[model samples]
Target: MAETMTTTQTITVGARRLEVSWAGVTHVGHRRETNQDSFLAEFPLFVVADGMGGHAGGEIASQSTVRRLHDVVDSADVGRSAIEGALERVVKDIAAHPETTDEGTGTTLTGVFIESDDEGSRWVALNIGDSRVYLLRDDHLVQVTTDHSVVQELITAGKLSPEEAEGHPYSNVITRAVGASELTPPDYVTIDVRAGDRFVVCSDGLTKELTDYGIQHFLRQHPTPGAAVDAMLAAALENGGRDNVSLIVVQVGDSSSTEDVHAE
Candidate 1:
């Protein structure tokens, strides 16, 4: 097998009205021939999707979901409600598409949208299935979105312990996904924004490999968004990256404020 590799990409687009930096990484797992995950940082829109289906249907589903999301965002300036509506619309469209419908292709998407005005910026997270969004504030990590999957539900109902859920046979069987039905509702959460807060959007691959302690330590140590993303990906691979891993790290506030955040 070719040696597993990792790469990073960063873009600084738009005016300096606000400082925004994001980093993403995706790796084809040791066992898979094609990567079925996708991550995007389209300025105000950041998304991560883990696709499922047969053949290359998974890949096509994830890519199509991202493209469709971009289209919706492009046509309208959306708030939290609008974002949820867009997600619902996309899922319906995916279900209606003949090629995808017959194959039952679907994907889990966790998206974060940030908007800024003269006052400041606000953020909301939209999620379907198990991909996650975590917020880091004052050096503490908090899971902002609930997983819409069978194992997660079991854990919630106390039928399965956190440790047991990890190895469950149905751990990957998601109960909800975009395009799973004619219309699927995303669990959207509006989070209070603070200047020093940071957010991570990642596939289950990273969370599965790294403990919360490991993630918080690495993220706290590497303040640079790109560097943080790289370190997280490296650590996941080091711990037997059994699945494709992808992550995006974003920090709030201006560059100077971000420096202050890490200086603490």
Candidate 2:
């Protein structure tokens, strides 16, 4: 994988403005023959999708969803409703695709949508399946999206511990995903944005290799998104790289207040 690089962009809504620096990287990993993960890092939106299916179905599913989102975002029509509608359309399109019909092709979708109103700027975190969205604020990292996987349900039901779930055979069996069903709806939460907030949106590959503490350690050590993303990818690859790895790190703050940190 190449060294991670950061790109700065700004999101404005009404009278509110958010200066955002972000970086994204994806790898085929040590085991996978093909990369099935796809991502988007445009301003006002960031996404990570982990695809699953037989043959090329996984790749197709992930790419299709991201392309649809790119179109919707490029049209300047963005919001909870827009995202939901776009997902619905993508599902329909996938079902009608010759290669995906009856093949059970699907992809996990997770990320944040930036929105602004008269009050101020806010972030809407969205999720479907096991891919995750995490927030680092006040030096604390919190996972904002819940996984819709068998292991997650087992953990919630008190049938499994977090440590146990890590090695569970059903850990990869996601219960919900985009394009898996026409009725699948993503879970979302809207929260007020704060300066100095950092977000990590990633596939299960990274989490499978590192614990929350490990992730936070790198995030804190690498102050800039570029360095943080690179450090994370290197760690995951070193740990095992058992599956395709994809991630996007985003930091929000005033332009002058945030300093870019690069890895040597």
Candidate 3:
């Protein structure tokens, strides 16, 4: 059976305290024989990794990548350099793994690392391929991460329109990924957090099936992070589950909120 996980946490950054409610879901989709996507939704960290290789290699690459992040989060060393160091280790580990080495496995990773500073709570959005991070603020949705893919390059070069690139045959061809090289440094940006902000991180499967407008519509309809996650997974399947789908929704609020953190 598929597993849907939900959790909440109260994080204190400097003098700012935030009660974060979050949930995640993963689906095998219609076309793929095996689900190669992996996610981590623990407080202070949320990530989605979409594996690309043969069946076995793809799964290994993604799982290994997340495992490394899991360790880093547990160690409570979520600084920029620490995250980059963990990713570097994963690249070497995957390169040495027999399963991935034989088939040339790689995976796209995108998500956020929450950290505290003198300024208050901040979110470090990270990306290393076509997977994406999006923000919803004041009822508006904005994509925060840039895709490192061939079609994205074309769009940047003014050679193709956004609509045209969406349907482009090379849409799935990513330019950078973990396990593809000995060193993979993700692109990241730090942003201040607000009480009403909502963040969505997902693999390409969700974007391929739903546009940004569609995602925003669902986020508006769902009252909580879990509801939004379910809505997205259902919409992807209804449209055409061409690839494995995975997503995590995180909502920020005051500590007085009724929601309490619980283990899955």
Candidate 4:
């Protein structure tokens, strides 16, 4: 909760170039003793992790994952392999550290990274748990990542509705994680980049307080990344910051010529 962190830079990939502005923020919140979330928002990648466990293992799990991810992204062109390899290293990284637990320590990893293929530059969103990535384009907001939690499974199976799943007893139970996988790997979604695209990469902390409508309203009201991030965090805390909050707001410049994308 210092001054809002903001950065604007030009990133070049292949023959394509993008002017990007981003802001990142994290808070311990009103109910948590330690902030169990970590994030890395750099040129080619932006990721958020929410750690779970006792005995400081949660902090270690989240910190290690982001550190390894930062190491993996120390290159010009980032792709799916880099994220997979980094996650693979996360296992070893946790093993080497005695601060972690066998079954208790794990993390929810989610984020968006820039990927370049033969055609052109694009966005690749990845997720392993309940953390989320939302894209706002042409005034429409879409959650690009799926949740791996118990309530989500029930909702998918038609056993529970969205409103019913909100306060469910199993809402906090995640079926898969980076340390303990429930026989599933991370999910990936590749998106074509546009100049006006805006994304929200966040932990459940932020979503627990803000509705999809609230998120879209804030993004629409604040065009700059820093302003949007600040507004969202303030709103989350005001509603009731029951969990540690963390998020990164990212935007691509030069939106004058991009076509409007409909929510499908």
Off by over 4 Å in 2: 11-17, 101-103, 255-264
| Candidate 2: tens digits of C-alpha lDDT, residues 1-264 | 555889998766444576789999999999999999999988778999998887778887899889989987898877877888888878887787778846679899999877655666567888999999888987988898889999989999999999898889897899898875675778887756667889999999999898999889999999999899999999999999999999999998762223222111
**lDDT agreement with native, every candidate:** 0.75, 0.85, 0.85, 0.85
Give candidate 3 misplaced runs (Cα > 4 Å). Answer: 1-5, 101-103, 255-264
**What lDDT would candidate 1 get against the real structure?**
0.75
Write out the backbone clash pairs for model 1: none
Candidate 3 total steric clashes: 0
Clash count, one per candidate = 0, 0, 0, 0
Candidate 3 per-residue lDDT over residues 158-257, each given as its tens digit: 9999989867899889889988577668888776666778899999999989999999999999978888899899999999999999999998886322
Instruction: Summarize candidate 4's per-residue lDDT along 91-154 as a digit string, tens digits.
Output: 6776667777765688999988877667666777889889999999878899989899999999
- Residue pairs with backbone overlap in model 2: none
Q: RMSD for all candidates, in order, please.
A: 5.6, 5.2, 5.2, 2.7
Q: Which lDDT value does model 1 have at 133?
A: 90
Could you tell me every candidate's TM-score relative to the true structure?
A: 0.82, 0.91, 0.92, 0.91
171-210 per-residue lDDT for model 1 (tens digits): 8888888765665667777664455677899998888899
